[model samples]
Target: MAFESLASRLQSAFDKLRGRGKIDEQAVNEAMREVRLALLEADVNFKVVKDFVARVKERAIGQEVLKSLTPGQMVIKVVNEELTELMGGNVAKIAVAAKPPTVVMMVGLQGAGKTTTTGKLAKYLQKQNRKPLLVAGDIYRPAAIKQLQVLGEQVKAPVFTLGDQVSPVEIARQAIEHAKENHLDYVLIDTAGRLHIDEALMDELKQVREVAKPDEILLVVDAMTGQDAVNVAESFNQQLELTGVILTKLDGDTRGGAALSVKAVTGQPIKFAGMGEKLDSLEPFHPDRMASRILGMGDVLSLIEKAQEAVDTEKAKEMEKQMRQGEFTFDMFLDSMQQMRKLGPLEDILGMMPGMNKMKDLKVDEKQLGRVEAIVTSMTLKERANPDLLNASRRKRIAAGSGTSVQEVNRFIKQFEEMKKMMKQFSGMADKMQKKSKKKGFGLPFMGKSAGNLPLKERGPGFPFNFKPPFK
Candidate 1:
């Protein structure tokens, strides 16, 4: 959503070159001109935009078009790769200290989402099974300490506070000792933030750094700051020796200039991105995925990787085999749903899909899936395994049992039948694809079907509209 305007502008620029078989120098120049304006409008740093456009032009001009591909797509691909390179090509992991109780000091300006990001980082580390202790090192604001405490409670991480009476350096030192005593693996010290750069703040941060001996000093910055965000990062890095940065408020209506500027200017990988206000909304920064999302091309690679992490491979293989044999049933579908549940919430799962984020107008009811789950739970084991055994009396009983109308039950059954049919067709296609992949060693990018053009009616009973390509 934050990248919507930029996505539209870039898409339009590329659309102009869509059908061109060969990208001539003139065409590339024209496209680059549009791209330049788009980036500027998106609040990108002037120098960064210039350099980015130059690299894209260098790769796009006179490049031979791929078979069955338009020049626009090729240019988009080049821009994506350049964007990825500019943002750090690979994912960066937080470094653990050689010693125990790895210290992480957070530095940022006021309203930069520093306190929230501190909590998100704690949640992230805790998810990795690390015992983290959050220290309220911000002595200036009472509300800041309370916010950290609330966040600490939310994350179920311990909060260390010395109240507003103590100096931040003393609090940080004591917090580190507490971390050592408790055998906490990580200590996150949330320090004070100023609205702007000031001498006193920098001096205070330096003092806290000396006391904490932080393994990593992460500068948390708001993505909405545009180019000024880069200046903040630079100033922080210059004084605090920041190891990395966390770009927060990325889910806000930001111009995306901060994200582009921070990494390129500071030469520090963006360690994480704050995608939403939820405590669990933070995600490890992925350059390629972000690039794809910006260009409106979708981030298929990250989506597949997320699926790999979420899905049970052995069960997936079994399901694949069953579908190939046209044996996919309601039971199999339920099992798959349960497996998906194991991967985290459905919303998070869908968010990682390539074009799913683009479906702003398509109101897909997530509650319907809950209803299906409820209906499935209401079914008996035999009914779940063999839907053919459900006669009229059984259907009526199931309808009553699920607290739904008989018509709803009938609709569910009809939808299940159609899903089974679709699964069989999909399986056949998948089998052919598997054979082709075995021969070629590179699988198709997608299912080889355009989900973008799917008819709304065929998208399942409760589905409101055709599925977008995935994270559009």
Candidate 2:
């Protein structure tokens, strides 16, 4: 949902120029005026906005081939490229020390989600088969230490705490020693946060840096802070010599100006994004993909990565075999739902799916999936594993247990039957598509989502259409 407003406005402005064979100065001027307003409304820095508009105008006006294609598309492409360049032309990877115990110090203001991100980074490292030690370095806030402890428990990472009596620098030193003694692969120090920039805080962080000698100093900033976030990044980077930034609260209603301006302002690559409060919500930053999403073009690679991360390949193969054999039942459906749930929010996952958002207007009854799950759960093991045995009495029992009427249960059964039929029909097509993808070297349909049908679902409850019409 980052840059939702800017995306909507820009898409609208470009919509009017789609089919134009020629573009004149007046038409280009009109589009630029709207774009200017959109950028300002998106809370972009005034100077950045001015420079962006000027560069865009210079290029657009000089391009004499405006008569060949709609000027709006050309402008959109230019804006996308400029935006990508503004955010950092390339993705930056976190620095991992060649030696063991790659230290990463997390620094940020209070309420910036630094402590949580520290735990997330530990988990991320652990996923890479690294033994990470979490050092609770926040001395002021007792809750901060406890939060780190809880996260350590969640990720099964060891936590080092000095019980608020010792200095953060002392705690960090002890933690590094502990990491060295235990042969830990990484040490993530969660440093204290201040309400604002202060000399005392900076000095304390500097001392911790000296003691820890972190390979990566990540400046955690709240993306919801807008331009203030960029300012904070600049201030922190100036003093701490930050290696990268972790933009937290990206799932919030952030205008995305900070995300777009941070690298340009502070010259630090955003190494990771805090998508949610969960431990697994952290994502590696990808500038080009983010630029595409901001332009309402969707991020296909991210979607595929997420699906691959979430889906169990062995389970998928089993399910595919079952579907091909026309043996997929309530158990398989429940297993599929559980697997999808591990991927996180339905909307976020679906949004990444190609063309899944195209049916937003049909109101793809997400609750129906929940209802189906509940109904299946209410069934006895025999009844659930064997759907054909769900007679009238069984249906009534399921409805009562699931807090629905018998009619709803029957409807769900019928829908499941339809799904089974569809799967049977899709089996051959899926195989053919799989072969085509192998030949083409790209994921086939349903491997990921497309952005073309955003605000629309590929298949909704009310609509029976098999094809998505061109949204634009």
Candidate 3:
């Protein structure tokens, strides 16, 4: 939901263009005007917006695009490409040192979530099989070093501290030696931040940079601060010659001005983004995927990556077999819900699917999933495995245990049975299709050999139950 308002406004502008049979330059100009206002309202830097709209207009008015069969879509394509280019065209990877112990200096103003992002970066490195040592270099702020130490402990990375007695420059220099001695692959120096940009802070950061000779100097900025975040990045880049930026609180930045403006202003790519407060919420910034999301095209690649990371493959295969056999049950339903929860919030997950944004009335209440899980959990093991055992008395007991009315329990059961029947129909159709494919001496493209070979299970739940649709 970072660019919720901006995306909605932009999509609205595009919608009007799409409705036209053929667009003239005047119509294109009109749409661009709307786009300009939308971008400005989103808090994008005014000059950036002017240049962006000008570029889009120049291309959109070209004969090649205006004469295209789908001129409207052509215009949108141009906008998407330009937007992606503005955001850095591609993912910016973290720098690696030629030698071991890559030193990264994290700098920013106070209250920008710099310390927390340092810990998140350490966790990201650990996932890449690198041993990262976190240095507690923020000695000025109250408990800044302690905060970094807590984060290091949470990520299981060793924190090197000089007890706030030594100068940050010396601490950073010694921390590198410590990392070298321990054979750590990366050394993250959490430098102190001030309430605002000041000469004293810049001088101290400069000294630390001189000693550490950091491979990367990343400026962390809060996305919710709008253009102030961009200004901070510009100031830091001027003094530190920052290699990249880390945008935190991006998930909560509805207007997303900083994310849209920072790279353009600072001439640095956003290397990472903090999507949530969790230590694992940090992700490599991908501009192309972000543009796709802003245009309501959905980020299928990121969604697939998240699924591959969060969902167990073997378990998914086993669940697939159960679906093919029409053997899904309450236990399977509970398990599937738990797996889905690991992928993040339901609304965010749904937003990643193509065309989901167009479903204006679609609502995904995460609490509903939790409630369903509670109902399933209240059931006895035998009841969970065998739906037929959920008689009236048992339904009442489950309803009571789950803090719901018996009528709600009955409704859930009815929906579950309907879902099972639908799965059975799908299973039979799949079998017939497979047989036909074998007879034709060719495999179905969508149903690969791995999926087609999954044998049926005698007893299990049907495919995970589809929640009641919230579509109006």
Candidate 4:
């Protein structure tokens, strides 16, 4: 929910033109006015907002839009393209050296998550079969080296530290040599940061940049800082000549001003975004996907990628076969929950699907899901494979074991039975579904309707714990 407020406002502005056959100048102007106010309210740079509005208005009011069969949709398309261009038109990839041991200097202010981001970058690189060595170059902050070392261990990357007793500049210089000796492909130098930019900090960073001769100098800025994030990027770019930017806290309760404003302000592409605190949460910044998300169009590619990463292909095929055979036991239910949890939060998954933003009012209590998993876990294997074994006393025992009331266990059992029946129906057309999709994507047992044929309880938006949406 990076641009929760801004996205809602923009969606509302375009609502007036939703069904209009012919988009007039008056309609476009009104929408632009709302867009302008929304961007300003989100703390976007004044100049960036003005220019963006101008560009969007120019295209929106043109004859081409007026001539389109679906002018309303055309106007939104123009805005989406403009928004994508305003934030770097494509993914800015990291620099690869002609020689191995590509050096990257991480520079930023304190609290911008420089250390955590470094670890994430290491993880991202390793996913691509690249060997990376993390350098503990932030000696000024107490325990900075220890923190990087811990992250290095977590990511399974080696941490190169010269100890706090040595200068960071020397540590960075030596880290490159160490990477060369170890045949590591990338050396990430986690440089020191300050509360604010100062001559001392800049000088130290410059020295590291000089000695390391980094292939990439990335400025990590906190996206929640709004305009201040842009200012920080500007300051760092002026001195360090950053090759790209890394935005942290983009997944937090941010207005998303920094993401929209930083590139336009500093003339730098955002290479990566820190989505969450998890080590695997750092993602390559995709401008078009981000623009689509802001407009509530969804990021289908990213969703598929997350699904593919989180799911085991072999296990997925087996699970689908079981579901098709009407053999979805409680054990399978627990396994599905574990796999879905690996795809980050359920809300984030919803945000990546078209029109799901409208269900913003719907909340998925992950803790409640955890409790459901606990209920399944508390069951004995025999009880899991055969629900009939769970008689009154057995249900009471399960309730006690899972730290819940008997009524709760009964409610879960009822929902699971409903879901199992639905899966049987789904199995009837399994071959047809398999033909349509390359393979079956992960399914939520009792969540999100698969289609009109799929049933949703009249009592609530979704069954089981009732993840109710605002709409009926």
Candidate 5:
């Protein structure tokens, strides 16, 4: 939710235009004025905001938009396109060297999360089937080498270190040789950072860069710093000639000025973004998708990618089969919840779905999931498989075990029964639709021919508890 405030403001401005049947110059000017204020308030650089608004206004007031059948939508499209261009127009991929062991030197100021980002980047490269060797090149900070070693162990990547006694340049030089000897495909040098920019820090980083001959020097900046993040990137790029940027703490950056302005100011594309503190939360930056999200259009591509990464395809197919046959059990429900948790927070997942931005007041209580899990876990295996065994006495026992009232337990059971009925109705409806599609010699919309070919199983007993879907 990096751009939550800005998105809300922008959407409000657009809503005014959307309400009008025909847009006039005055209306466009008014909307642009609101947009300007929004950007400025979001802490975007004044020059960048001025230039962006100017470009957006020039195109929006053109005959192609003002004379269009749906002028409001046309103006919105202009803003979206310009916003995409304001950030890097295309995705900036990580640099790959012609030779083995692509060297990536991570550079940033202290407290910018540079070391953590190096670990995250190593994890990302590992997922791409590259064996990465992490170099503990930061010797100044207290326990920096130990920190990298801990992270390296967490990611299962080997850490190359020469202790704090050796010079960082020598450590980096030797680490490259170690990577080559080990047949590692990438060498990530976690360089030292200063509290602020200074000549000594720049000189040290330059020396390390010269020794490592890094194919990419990524400047990791904390997105929560707003415009200061952009300034940091600018200063680093001026001295080290940074190849790209990695904006960290983006999930907590509600203003999003850093993400929107860094590329423009430093002339370096954002190669990756740190979505969360988790090691696996680093994701390749996609400008178009980001623009879509800012405009409340929902990032479906990112959502699908998240789903593809988090959900097991084989298990999903099996789950689908069970749902169609009305055999979804408490065990399956627990498994599904665990799988969903892998995709990140429930609120964030819901935000990725189309039209969720309109429901601004929708609060997804994550603690409710834990409570349900506790309730289910309190039940015996036999009780889970056979809900009819849960009489009043059993219900009271479960309530006591789960630290809930008997009335709450009864409500949950009733909800589960209702869910089973709904699932059966949906299964029957899907069967009918598939049969009709077969007769028509085509597949159903969204769902293809695969929907018709699923092997059905015999229905199983329903668990008697009502649980709301994870996303409200």
Candidate 6:
């Protein structure tokens, strides 16, 4: 939802062009005008917005024929491409040293989430099967070292600390030696930062950098700070010659000025984005996927990646088999809910879906999923496996246990049955389609989700028990 307002505004601008069968230069200019205003309103840098609009206008006016696409669509395509380019065109990866112990210096103003971002980066490296050593070099802030230590323990990584007495320069120099001795592949130095940039802060960072000889110096900036974030990045880059940026609080930044302007202003790519507070929420920045999301085109690859990470593959397959055979039960439904929960918030999931532009704004019933889970959990194992055994009294008991009225339990039971029947019908349809096309297996792509009649983007996974996400 970072670019929610900007996306809506841009989409509205393009709607005019989309309505026209053929677009003229005047129409393209009009759309660009709206786009410029939208970007400016989003707090995007005035110069960046000016440059972006000029590029889009030049291309739209000189539009070439793209087969199977209307003139309006072509203009949109141009804008998407330009937007991608503006945000660094490709994903910039974290630098890896040729030898072990790739040194990374995390630097930014205080309160920019620099220390937390360092811990997240360590977790990310660990996920890649690399041993990362976290260096607690921020001795200035009270409890900064302890905070890093706690994060290290949470991630199961080792933390190198020298207490507050030693200089950060010495800490960095010694941390590298520790990593080398321990055979750790990456060393992340969480350097100290001031509330604002000062000569003293830069001098300390410079000294630390000289000692560490870091492969990457990442500038962590809070995206919600808008223009101030870009200005901070500019200041850091001028001194440290930062290799990349980590945009934190991006999930809360509706304006998205920092994300759009940081790289453009500082000549550094945004390597990672802090999507949430969770340790695993730091995502490698993907410019193309972001542009697609901003254009109301869902990021299917990211969605699939989330599914792959959250859902158990074997369990998903077994669940699909059961659903196809009409053996769907309360247990399976519970498992499906658990799997979906692992994928994170319904709003975020819906946003990643390709055609869910309208659905993203739907009030996410967070408690609805929890309510279903509670009801199912309150059921006996036998009752879960065989929901048919639930008579009126049993339903009443379940309602009481789950703290719901009997009517709610009855409604859930009825909806679960409907979902099972729907899954069976979908299985039959998928089989016929599979045979007709013979394209690789088209089984349920996710747990408890079927290939429904709705377009892939609009189709919410089938959780047909009270959670009415948009579906055909």
Model 5: lDDT equals 0.86
Better of 1 and 5 by lDDT: 5
Model 1 ranges with Cα > 4 A deviation: 58-74, 126-129, 143-156, 181-183, 194-200, 224-228, 251-255, 277-280, 312-335, 338-409, 420-472
Clashing pairs in 6: none
Q: What's the lDDT for all of these models?
A: 0.78, 0.78, 0.86, 0.86, 0.86, 0.85
Better of 1 and 4 by TM-score: 4
Shift of residue 221 alpha carbon in model 4, Å? 0.7
Candidate 5: TM-score?
Answer: 0.94
lDDT of 1 by residue, 1-472 (tens): 5676676777778877877766667887888999899889888878889898988888787435434267667777788889899888889889898888999999999888888888999998987889999999887865999999999988899999989999999999999999999899999999998889999999999999888889999999888877888898988888887889898878774468888777778888899988778787788999888888877667667657656766788987786566656575667777776776655555544545666555555444556766676777778999888888888999888888888878878888877777767666665655665676666564422322342233443222122112121121
Model 6 residue 73 lDDT? 89
- 2 versus 5: better TM-score goes to: 5
lDDT of 1 at 52: 89
Model 5 RMSD vs true structure? 3.6
Instruction: List, residue by residue over 1-472, the lDDT tens digit for candidate 5.
Output: 6688888888899999986779989999999999999999889989999999999999999999989989999999999998898889999999889999899999999999999999999999999999999999899999999999999999999999999999999999999999898899999999999999999999999999888899999999999999999999999999999999999998877788998899889989999999998999999999998888888898999988998999888987797777767575677777777888889987777777766766778767787777777777889998888777899999999999998889878887777777767677767765776677667654432246444343343222222224565454
Which stretches of candidate 6 lie above 4 Å from their native place?
63-69, 423-467, 470-472
lDDT of 3: 0.86
Regions of model 4 farther than 4 Å from truth: 427-472
Cα lDDT, model 2, residue 423: 64
* Worst 10 contiguous positions by lDDT, candidate 1: 461-470
Q: In model 4, what lDDT does residue 32 have?
A: 95
Candidate 3 stretches with Cα past 4 Å from truth are 440-465, 469-472
Estimate the lDDT of model 6.
Answer: 0.85
